[model samples]
Target: MPISDDIKLGHAERLLAQLRESYLQDLPNHCGEIENLVLSFDRKDPETVFDEIFRHVHSIKGSAGTHGLHLISGICHHFEDHLKTLDGRFEKIDGRFINVCLAYIDCIRTAVSLFEKGGETLPLENELEQLRKRFLKNNLAGLLVSSSNYITMLCQQTMGDLPVKLTTVDDGFAALERLLQQKYDFIITDKELKQLNGVALTLAVRASDSVNRDTNIIMLTSKMSIDFPAGLAPDEILPKNTGLSHALVDAVGKIFNGK
Candidate 1:
C-alpha cells in the first residue's frame, strides 16, 4: 500500500508543528547568546564574535524560512547582510550596528513569541519596510570606476534616488588607491579602465589589505571569453551593449533589495 496525499499532508503538518515548537523553545537561548555577544562585544575578538553571531542568525534564518516563518527569515537576512559589512573591519566594529542587530533580534524574538502563542503572526510589514529603508539609507556606500563619463553619468542618474551614495573614478589605478584609503560596499568597473585594466584591478583588490578586500564588484565588457583567469572574479558582469544603463540599474536594484 502507498501513502495517500491526505496522509502525507498530515505527516507534514505534524513535522512542521514539531519544528516550530523546537524553534520557539530554543529561541530564548539563541537570543541570549546574541545579547551576550553584544554586551561583551568590546572585549572579545571581533572576527570570532561576528562569525559566531552570523552563524546563529543564519541558522535561524534558514530554519525559520523552512518552517514558514518568513518574517523571521527576512529580518535575519538583513541582519546577516549587515554582519557581513563588519567582515574585514572586525577590530573597529561599529557600536550603532551592534545595537541595530540586537534590536532586530528582539523583534524576531517578539514575533516568534506572538506566533507561537496565538497561531498567527502579527502584521509588521509597514514597520519592517521603514526599518529596511532607514538601514539602506545609512549603511551603504559604493563606487563606480569607469573611464567613460557617459557610463558614470548613467549610473549616477540611475542610483540618484536610491539609498546608497555612489562615487565615480575615471581610472582603475585611482580606484585601487581609493579602495586602500576608503571603504565601499560595492564597485562597478569597466573592462578597459585606464592606468590598469579591470581584471588587474580586481586581482589587486583581492590581494590587498584594504577594508574592502571582499567588496562586491561588477564588471562591464563588450566581449566575454572563457579564457579569462579564475581569480579575477567580479560579483556581477554586465554586457556593454545598447541600453546597458537599464541592465546595470536593474541588477543594482536586485542587489540592493537582496541586502
Candidate 2:
C-alpha cells in the first residue's frame, strides 16, 4: 500500500528538524556576512552587495520550502521580492534600505529560533513588521478575520495608530469572500471562528484564486496543540495571550504604513 500522506509528512518533518540544525549553525555566519556587507557597502558597488544579499535570501527561500519551512520561505519570498524590485541602481542601498537589509537578516536569524524552541527568541516580531510597513510603498487595507468582538477590539486598539483601512468579518466564509474580493495588505485571524475555522480559511485563501494570495497572514490563536494544516502556512502566528494586543499591533503594522 502507498504510504499515507500523514506518514510522509511525519518523515519530512523529521528530516527538516535535522536540516534545521545545520541551518541554525550556519545562520550566524550568514548574518555576520550581511552585517559586514552593510558596513562596507558604501565603498563597494551597491549592486555587488545587493546581489549577494538577494542570492543569500534566494537560497534560503528554496531550502526552506523544500524542508516544509514554508513560513520561513513565505517571509523570504516577500523579502526577496523587495530586493528584486531594486535589482539595479546600486545607489539606493543606504539609509532606509540598509535598515531593511539588516532587518531581513535579523528575521532569518529569528526564524531558526522559532521551530527550534517555540519562538522564545523571536522578540522582534513587532520590529520585523514595522520595518516591512515602513519600506513598502503602500501599506494599507487590512482584514480582521475573527468571530470574536474581543479580537477585533484588540487588533483595532493595537493598530489604531496605523492608517490601515480595516475590515472585519465574523464569518470565515465571508472572510474568504472578502479576501478574494479585494486586496489586503494584512490579515489577522482567530482559530475558533464560526462557519469556518481560521486555519481552514487561511488554507482556502492560500489555495484560492484570490489576487491577494501573497498577503501577509497572522494566525491569532489561543490554542496550543494545533498544527498548521498541510501545504498551508500562515506567515506568522500570534498567540492570544497576555501580549496579544502588542503582538497583533506589531504584526499588523509590519504589512502596512499609512505614514
Q: In candidate 1, what residue range of length 10 has the lowest lDDT sum?
A: 119-128
Question: After superposition, which runs of candidate 2 have C-alpha atoms over 4 Å from their true positions?
Answer: 1-16, 120-126, 137-203, 206-259
lDDT tens digits by residue: candidate 2, 141-228: 6778888887788777777777665667789986775566445687888888988998888888888866568788888876756676
Clashing pairs in 2: 129-254, 139-256
Give the Å error, residue 78, model 1. 1.0
lDDT of 1 by residue, 113-154 (tens): 777777454355455555555566764577889899888887
Cα deviation at 50, candidate 2, in Å, is: 1.6
RMSD after Cα superposition, model 2: 13.5
lDDT, model 1, position 135: 62
Q: Model-by-model lDDT, in order?
A: 0.76, 0.72
Once superposed on the true structure, which residue ranges of model 1 sit more than 4 Å away at CA?
1-5, 119-123, 138-239, 242-259
